[model samples]
Target: MKEFTFELPTKIYFGTNMTEDVLQKESAQFAGNVLIVTSGRSLITYGYLPKLISIIEHLPGNEKVVVYDKITQNPKLKEAQEAISLGKKEHVQSVVGFGGGSSIDAAKAVAAGIASDENIETFLLNGREPDGNVLPIIAIPTTAGTGSELSKGAILSSPAHHIKAGIRGKKLLPRMAVIDTSYTWTVPERITCETGFDVLAHAVESYVAVKSNAFSEMFSEKAIRIVGENLPKLIRNPGDHAAREQMCFASMIMGSNLANIGTCLPHRIQYAIGACTESSHAAGLIALYPSWIRHEFEVNPRKLNHVFQWLGYDPVNDAAQAEQLFSELKTEWKIPYSLSELGIRESMIEDLADQVTGNLANDRLSEKESIIRSILKESYLFRQ
Candidate 1:
């Protein structure tokens, strides 16, 4: 049992009606105006945003709610800075993240930038550390993936630099996380598959990361089991609220687990892919995870076996069984099986490979460019 230190300061409100039941009460924790960071039109179209706004406006004080919906897929550093600038101008004292991982992460970055004079660009590229002076953030996860609600790392992309990195510190952790399964009930089937895979990636990668300890491993194991059992069900029947609830819990657990232990090759590589091709983060992971497991299974057979067993597969000699499992899941879930299908050109392989940092800190994996290139090649095309 390796030594570890852990603390989760975020207050979590789980189950149904959490948002409408406690949004104003929780928002009252911080005085002054509040900023709501949201992404895309899904939540807005679903009317979640208006309902949230109504709750905030009904608060006791003259607390104004400002909505910033400029967040995009693979959230950009400039966007976060823009949000921070808006928050500062509005005299915002707190933030509410009201959508998926991108929205929540952008909100956290905005929170961090509000606390410091250093811009978000400086923090992403120059290795600046946050001073824990961030405005309070309340995360409401509308998606059952990325686990951004419970995580302390806010992933941001700098398009000019073509880099996707995270600002990780205890300060980025949400002051409150509201997990309501009702928010995820309307997620489309394809998105369910994509984000569902992300949930599994966090569980598996964090469990096998070099920094993993007894506490994180326990959470990771449970998260993996929950996802393995429930994701497929939810994918098959989007109306399964019970399965959706389980997935929401698993996603939260994985988020907390990743915050503590970090992730391995698949996640590290997916960042590079997302930066290069602007592809879906979960899609890239789905394309690469099996190949990665096959490549590293021999180096850490015990860990791989544990994962396989938990997922109801038996890999006697290698990751063949694991690969087969995901392949079947991909076909059943109708997810694209190759990067090319996701619009990543094969010609950009070297560009993608060059961006790979292999900074997973895994003893079984190397950060070497040659090794990363090899993994990319294997993952470029789907093998039947």
Candidate 2:
């Protein structure tokens, strides 16, 4: 086994109704002012937001709770700035991320900005590091994807610059993470399917990542198996509580895997696609998976075979067969398989490839521009 080190600083509370229990106990450490960052009114419409507020308001030393519900999908840097302004104005001493990955990512940026009192764009766009003055964060995931609650990275988009990227730091990890499976019970079928695909992507990419070690692969393999066995059950019967629990667990562990080893080409490419198009993050990844799998099969067949076996497929020596199996899985889940389906034009492929940023060290392929353009073209015209 290769030498490696791992650490997870976030205190996790996971269960059916562990949300109230965790918040009730943890909120005591919060200051007089708190900020709740969310995507929209879904939490309120579903009563989760109100319940969270009630719990915090009744806790000692929590005199005020502010809600910032303007977060959107693929959260923008400006959104984080706005949220930070709100948090600073309200004197928020702590932050709560109360929804999906987008909400949680925005919350982390807000927390960093509020405490550092600096433009978070420097951290997101440039290579500036946080000064370790970030406010404490509590993460409550409403969906079983992204795993932002347990991650030390925050993905934010800059609309003006036409870039979407991540800010990573140990200080960004939440002080507490509440993983209540009940929150995912109300997720729409499409969202559940897409988010489940996100879990699968995270595991597959991390398992093959150049930085992966024995310890991270342990979590990656288990998460892949769990998502494969449970995602389809949840899709067929959305009321499968057992499957829901398994997926939720899988998502959290995958988050830890992501934090430790990180992802490869698919995630990096998707950031560019997200910056250019209105495609959902999971949709872009699903579209790119066939090409990514084919690449892995060529350069790292042994690792790809492990992933195939965990997904219940017989060992295959052929790259085409490996790609086909993944294609079939997405088809079964009713996900789109081509970038064209997500509004990518043939002319836009080069620009998309050029926009891709961040480390590609985990990918086996050389980070040549021609190679990236070819991959984008293949994903765009795949099966068209």
Candidate 3:
């Protein structure tokens, strides 16, 4: 086994009504102001946000809370900076990331911005390291994908640079994470399917990354198995409480794996696609994964075989079975399987390849620009 080190400091509170218990216990450390960052009407429409506010309102001492609901689908650097400015203005001593990955990512940026003097722009665009003054964050994930609650990395896009970037540091990890499976019960079927795909992608990519170690792969293997067994069941019967809990468990493990070992070519390509198109993150991943598997299967077919078996497929002699499974999953989920269908054209392929080749490192996939271009083109035209 290769030598490796792992540490996850995010305290997790899990169960049906653990949200209130977790928040009450964790918020006591910050006696001053707190900022809640979220997006959309779902949390509010469902009364989760109001419930959280009620909990905060009753906290002992003069604990003030503010809400910033301006986060969008994929977080932008400008918006993160804006949220950080608000946190600073409110004099918030800590932050609560109260939605999906975007809101959580934005909250992390806000936490770093509020605690240090460095410009948020530099951190987003130039990859500047934080000064370790970040405010403590409490993560509450309404969606079971992205696993932002337990991750030390925050993904943000800059329109000016036309790229999606990540800021990573130990300080960026949330102080605590609260997982209540009930919060994910209301996720729409389509979103449920797509986000489930995201969980699988994180597991697969991290498991196969060159930087992966025994510790990361242990979590990745368990997460991969959990998502494989439970995702389709959850999609078929959205009311399966056991499946929901299993997926949440898988997502949490995958988040820790991703932070520890990082992801491979597929995730890097997905980020590049996000920079150019309005495609959902999981959709982009679904569209690209088959090609990625085809390219890498020759390097290590046993790894691919293990993944196929984990996903409940019979042992395959060739990579074609994996591609076929990919198509079947896409059709079953009603996800678009072509980049052209998602408005990413042939013209954008070169730039996408360049962006991905520049940012991501992988031992299996060739980093040659021509090979990367070919992979992107195949992913674009892969209708089957």
Best TM-score among the predictions, by candidate number: 2
TM-score of model number 1: 0.95
Q: Global lDDT for candidate 2?
A: 0.88
Ranking by lDDT: 2, 1, 3
* Residue 314 lDDT, candidate 2, scale 0-100: 92
The global Cα lDDT (0 to 1) of model 1 is 0.82
CA deviation > 4 Å runs, candidate 2: 367-369, 382-384
lDDT of 1 by residue, 144-189 (tens): 9899998988888887898888787888899999999999999999
TM-score for every candidate vs. truth?
0.95, 0.97, 0.96
Deviation of model 3 at 128, angstroms: 1.6
Quote the positional error of residue 346 for candidate 3 in Å.
1.2
Off by over 4 Å in 3: 357-359, 367-369
Clashing residue pair totals per candidate (backbone < 3 A): 0, 0, 0
How would you encode candidate 3's per-residue C-alpha lDDT over 280-302 as one tens digit per residue?
A: 77888888878777767767688
Clashes of 3: 0
Decreasing TM-score order of the candidates: 2, 3, 1
